[model samples]
Target chain A: MNDDDILEQAARWRSEGKGVALATVVSTWGSSPRPAGSHLAVDQDGAMIGSVSGGCIEGAVVLEAQEAIKSGNPRLLEFGVSDEDAWAVGLACGGRVQVYVEPIE
Target chain B: MKGALLDRLLAERAAKRPAALVTSLNGGGQSLVTAEETHGDLALPLNVVAAARTALRSDRSGIVEADHSRFFIRVYNPPLRIAVVGAVHIAQALAPMAALAGYEVTVIDPRQAFATESRFPGVRLVTEWPDEALGALRPDRRTAVVTLTHDPKLDDPALEVALRSDAFYIGALGSTRTQAKRLHRLQELGFNQEQLGRIHGPIGLKLGGRAPAEIAIAILAEATQVLHQGEAAEAEAAGAL
Candidate 1:
């Protein structure tokens, strides 16, 4: 989504007394679908802003952000197509991303 | 107060400035306790719709805080610039792509016929000689330059100027042989092997397509890669740290 859209959503969340969190696609490796710097904002209610991956990783990232927003903690989440423990989330292009999450309430 | 900060960010972005909207996901969100209204809280708290009413009216920074637990919404302004030194077919394709990719594109060419408004729609076309044109273009960290002229006389001086700057990517289009000759000349001009290595010679990734549009896509992709990778040497330095 555009920066304005994201900012608008963020403002809306903060005003409503709801917890908010921002997730950024800080870095991506090999054959990634989404560009780095793509952003998504998540509220305590599972609402989202922007998009990181097409649809593959948003749910996972939203879940991560929700926890942070609720707990007022931060985290770095990773999703990739690595083998062994990669059965849950497997990207077709073997893309991996480092997500920086910050809680905002 | 939080609303005012958010509105500034939106305005900057709408104005086509490279503004970054930083949200707090899992990091400690910066608290702007002083950002609160000194008057008092609303009996019915001002919703965002209400907040946006005078969002741009105030100079309040955009951060909301209850305590140490707070969220930051910072807008970072980064300029978007692209200097394209050519009026060739590839440049025609590349110019709009730069615009679509959010760059303030400047097309510098010695040929007025080749570099015109009709030819490059929405591009800032400067029909001037290369060396002089390159001098006008600012090469910042966010800027990128592409030399599609494939002419040593036009490309060399501009490329030299670009090489000395902090532009994220410097690409020159042509086959490997032509690229080799161009680099040889750059070397004669006193650029070392390491500096010469910085150029994305034979520009664009090996998309193996002859179409100008396809070549443009490869160049965009390569540019995006360079922008995010943060430089291999810098990455290595970070690793060492």
Candidate 2:
């Protein structure tokens, strides 16, 4: 799906009473997979509509998104080559990215 | 983000008005910024608002450091568009190619037989006369216009309307002699030298190919070049500060 469709889908899910969280790639450094505005929408049930990373860190982002949905608090997540979570989460492409996750009410 | 704020942002985007959603990385703050107004509950400082306007002008989204926190400026600009004032073979090849390159393509021609759906599937087909079609199209700064009919009757009318608009790129297909003749006619129409110079006659880069598809590639390459000509200036302006 394109960028617009992902946001529309998030709104649709929210209207359906499903908990939704939006994760946007706020910044990137080195050879990041996605640009700064790329989005990934995740629901409480672990369902996702788009991707912030090509495939490198969606799993980690989804986990963070679910947590944000539950806590009702936004989060600024940073993943880089030097972080162990980056390696564990498999952002093995030697790039760094900052994602902002916020719950949709 | 509140649903109401998201709706407003989407509405602004639907109306093709540029907007930015500024989110504080430290959380607990967000604001929606537009050309003449600001929305959302966040009480943004003047520097953040100025940064948002600069981001809108540059058409780039990223993090801005201000207010002792980081704000992510996510921009929403209208999609770029192209209006090809002919349904000829070059347009047939160009329409889909332009679409794939992320431009909304419209093929305009009054000839019913030439502008049929089968000839240009999935592309907007305007059967109205060239001038009327373009007048309605209202070529904006994000738009590109190309005249490929090679007939002055059809091409000239579209060229006249397109030249008057803020279209980022305007090109017409012809030889050097044909371009001189076309320029002469436009000059007679009260267009000044600089206005007439906006028409990139001979339409495309000199790829030295006569095939329709090859010519389309040349045209698209040239248009792409014209489209991105502002980036360097923007970067330079940013650097100067």
Candidate 3:
């Protein structure tokens, strides 16, 4: 929601020793609901920070963010249609996006 | 550098600065498996949640005030950062998406006309030429540089800077032919094959279309895969993360 709310929560998690992964929506196309610069924080417990698209994509992102944290691997995750993504995440509107996923250290 | 980055991000977040945190990945002395957050260390008292009234009483140095119920354990050491060169239309779409995915975004462009504060309201906009910008911008490991400027003068110099730096994601925007031409120039300028390997030309996912916004999405989407799911096949890479 608010920036401080997120900071407070992220700080609390860090202080309390909770593993957290930060996910960001780096790019989007075609009537995507969320704007770019949206931030989502996925902790080990699956708590989320900012939103990427809308309700459509966050759940999926949380799963990936958690895995990233668990695996200690950072990845660029994408959603929607492209030549390569003809059968992937496939958004409802055929909108495409860039998601950079990394485990928070 | 890591500590300062953390401090800056935490302080900015704490102060509601709304500024983006951009980390240089695998830069000199940067590690992939063990890359540290240039920012993200914001600790506050956990006891505050238990006794809301006493939050102010706690001794806070590196500590801020957070709910005592909240816990802090480093989950991911260093998050990735996306550095945008040329805050153009594509950047408008790209910056916010990068932020949404949790990547700190920094926009560098010499064009004040295009790289103005209004264009990118929430992100960081650096009104400097790419050469000077990358020096101060510091393209490190885990950091990505995308050049959207159609002009080679703008993107080329930046590519040189980005290639030389430790930035993992170095991309230049143009057609395949344009990219080849640009590469030829880069070669003439003394960029070897190894150095050229680092640059991603004809930037963005090959979406087979040409809308600015759509192109922006494609570029960032491809960048996402490279930055996030570099190993996965390009076809299966697009998904929420």
The deviation in Å at residue A16 for candidate 2 is 2.1
Q: Against the true two-chain complex, what DockQ does each candidate achieve?
A: 0.16, 0.64, 0.06
For each candidate, give its TM-score against the true structure.
0.60, 0.88, 0.51
lDDT of 1 at B141: 75
Error of 1 at B179 (Å): 1.9
Model 2 interface RMSD, in angstroms?
1.5
lDDT of 2 by residue, B30-149 (tens): 889999999987888888888888887767788888869878888888878999998999999999889877788999999998999998888899999999999998999889999999
lDDT of 1 by residue, B1-241 (tens): 2345445555555664433233333343322112233121222123322332222222122433332422333323444578999888988888888777767789899878888888887778887788778777768777898999877888888899999888889999888999999989899999999999989978988888889999999998899888757644443443311
The full ranking of all candidates by lDDT, starting with the best, is 2, 1, 3
User: Which ten-residue region of model 1 chain B has the weakest summed lDDT?
Assistant: B31-40
Give the TM-score, chain B only, in order for the candidates: 0.72, 0.91, 0.64
Which sections of candidate 1 miss by over 4 Å?
A1-105, B10-80, B231-241
lDDT of each: 0.69, 0.89, 0.63
Candidate 2 chain B lDDT trough over 10 residues, lowest sum: B232-241
Candidate 2 docking class: medium
Tens-digit lDDT string for candidate 2 (A2-105): 66778888888998999999999999999999988889999999899888887989999999999999999988899989999899998889999999999987
**DockQ of prediction 1:** 0.16
Q: Distance from true position, residue B139, model 1, in Å?
A: 0.7
Best by lDDT: 2
